[model samples]
Target: MISTVLQAVGLFVATNIDDIIVISLFFARGAGQRHLTAKITAGQYFGFAGILAVAVLIALGAGAFLPVEAIPYFGLVPLVLGLRAAWSSWREYRDNDGDDDSDGDSATGKGSGNAVGVLGVAGVTFANGGDNIGVYVPVFVNISHTAIAAYCVVFLILVGALVYIARFVATRRSIAEILEQWESVLFPLVLITLGVVILVSGGAFGL
Candidate 1:
């Protein structure tokens, strides 16, 4: 049981890779206030929990209604999403702002906004969680429904905690800048890797 739980947790963490990246962008943009970070984090946690629970329950309770074969189709969703991100990243690199500071400065010269509204936060959380759901559905298809919910809850809490920590670091503007400078190369590399992972998981190589 313990090992199963650990495996579930690990998968949850892996599934949330895209969420972490999107939230990092929000932080870099300075979108949320100190308190707002907590709020948004909470929203993401609960939102993810809610979504996961629903998926599990629906799979269990409505198993007869769903096309079991559709389970693998979930993989296609993330593949498309990953391909989209890859395209976006390539475009961003091509349009690389010539005057944009490569040294952690905001390329658009825009201040991170303080008033990230509730709906906006929810929207961001949902958008960021999209890939997670895609990864999860396929994994949960054959698992016990309750186990799926448990994994979802645990995964969400971990993601929420990580987001909170990242936002806290975002408050320390100097730290954010310094880390970004040193890790700048890593950022694009991560984006590229995420794209590849999404495609691979979706069976794009076989397709």
Candidate 2:
């Protein structure tokens, strides 16, 4: 029980770090407002729930028809996604002239840009969720279906809470100023770390 709890806790943190960072960026862009944040959160929760449900279904259906050995390779999904996230993060830090504007906001722009448009929000969420799916593929082998569902529920709740907190912080004059001051350095470092961690775990670097 203890080991399982520890594993779950570790997985949760590892899988969600990049997502938290990206979401915080949007919040920094003023997507942090209560209404838009809630909308984005809702879209993410629904998307996550849908994806997790599909994964569950695949696991169960395939259990009756295929060999279990193929399961671990399912980690590859996150491996690819992690690489993409890393690249995106690196670009955010390196390019400097591509995406972000004068205010250090993503080129998509602030206010309207960070509004969490369906496409943008979904894309970001999907990319960030790579690690979560990878972790789930392996963990699902040991845990029950009910446990998986419960974990998904808990994850969504936590994500929503984090979005709320980040939005609030982004709205603060002092916090927003601080975030703007170190945009380039902080985003790259955080994303690079997250990318490496996810890739290593997903067996992408041959590690």
Candidate 3:
């Protein structure tokens, strides 16, 4: 049970780290946008719940067909996602001559005022969480349904905590700047590391 809780925490952190950036951006719009914060939080939860539902169904279906030992190979999903993210970041950096500002502007522009509504935020959260499905499916496949339910409970609580943390960070210019500056590099690295952890822990390579 302790291990399961720890695993849940780790999974939550790895999968949602990028969300902090997005949430912070939303909160950074100043006091006038305070009301939208609740909407964004609700959207994040709703979108994440949708992603989990899909992953759970897929995991159950795959579990019924795939051998237990082969489950870990699903780790390849996140591995590939990480590699693609790295490639995309590299391309963006090269294209912009290392000016990260352009990338930031592009991201902010896409999600700006356009995402003030609950559904809009939900859509953004779901879109950003595409890679989350890859990471979650294998984890869910290996765990019992009860365990999955517990994890979901933990995740819901953590989601609220994450929103609060993001709100706090939005007011901290230095930390927000640092996170924004390093997020591209950090996010891919975290995903890659998570994939390796899943593979090893799942005994994919018999390690």
Best by lDDT: 3
Mark the regions of model 3 whose C-alpha exceeds 4 Å error after superposition: 62-115, 173-207
lDDT of 3 by residue, 96-153 (tens): 6755467554443222322245664565565455467778888888989999988888
Error of 1 at 186 (Å): 15
Model 2, span 48-157: residue lDDT tens:
66446545655555544433333334444434433544466456546555544445345433323224454445544554455455457666767887677666666666
Cα RMSD of all models vs. native, in order, equals: 6.8, 6.7, 8.2
Runs in model 1 deviating more than 4 A are: 28-34, 61-114, 168-175, 178-207
User: Rank by lDDT, descending?
Assistant: 3, 2, 1
Q: After superposition, how far is residue 154 of candidate 1 from its true place, in Å?
A: 1.4
C-alpha TM-scores of all predictions: 0.54, 0.56, 0.58
TM-score of candidate 2 to 2 decimals? 0.56
lDDT agreement with native, every candidate: 0.53, 0.55, 0.68
lDDT of 3: 0.68
Runs with alpha carbons beyond 4 Å of true place in candidate 2: 1-10, 31-34, 61-114, 180-207
Winner on lDDT between 2 and 3 is 3
Q: lDDT of candidate 1?
A: 0.53
Give the CA lDDT, 0 to 100, for residue 166 in model 2: 63
Residues 76-159, candidate 1: write the lDDT tens digits. 433444344445444545555554654332343222322333444454454344455555666777777576767765776677
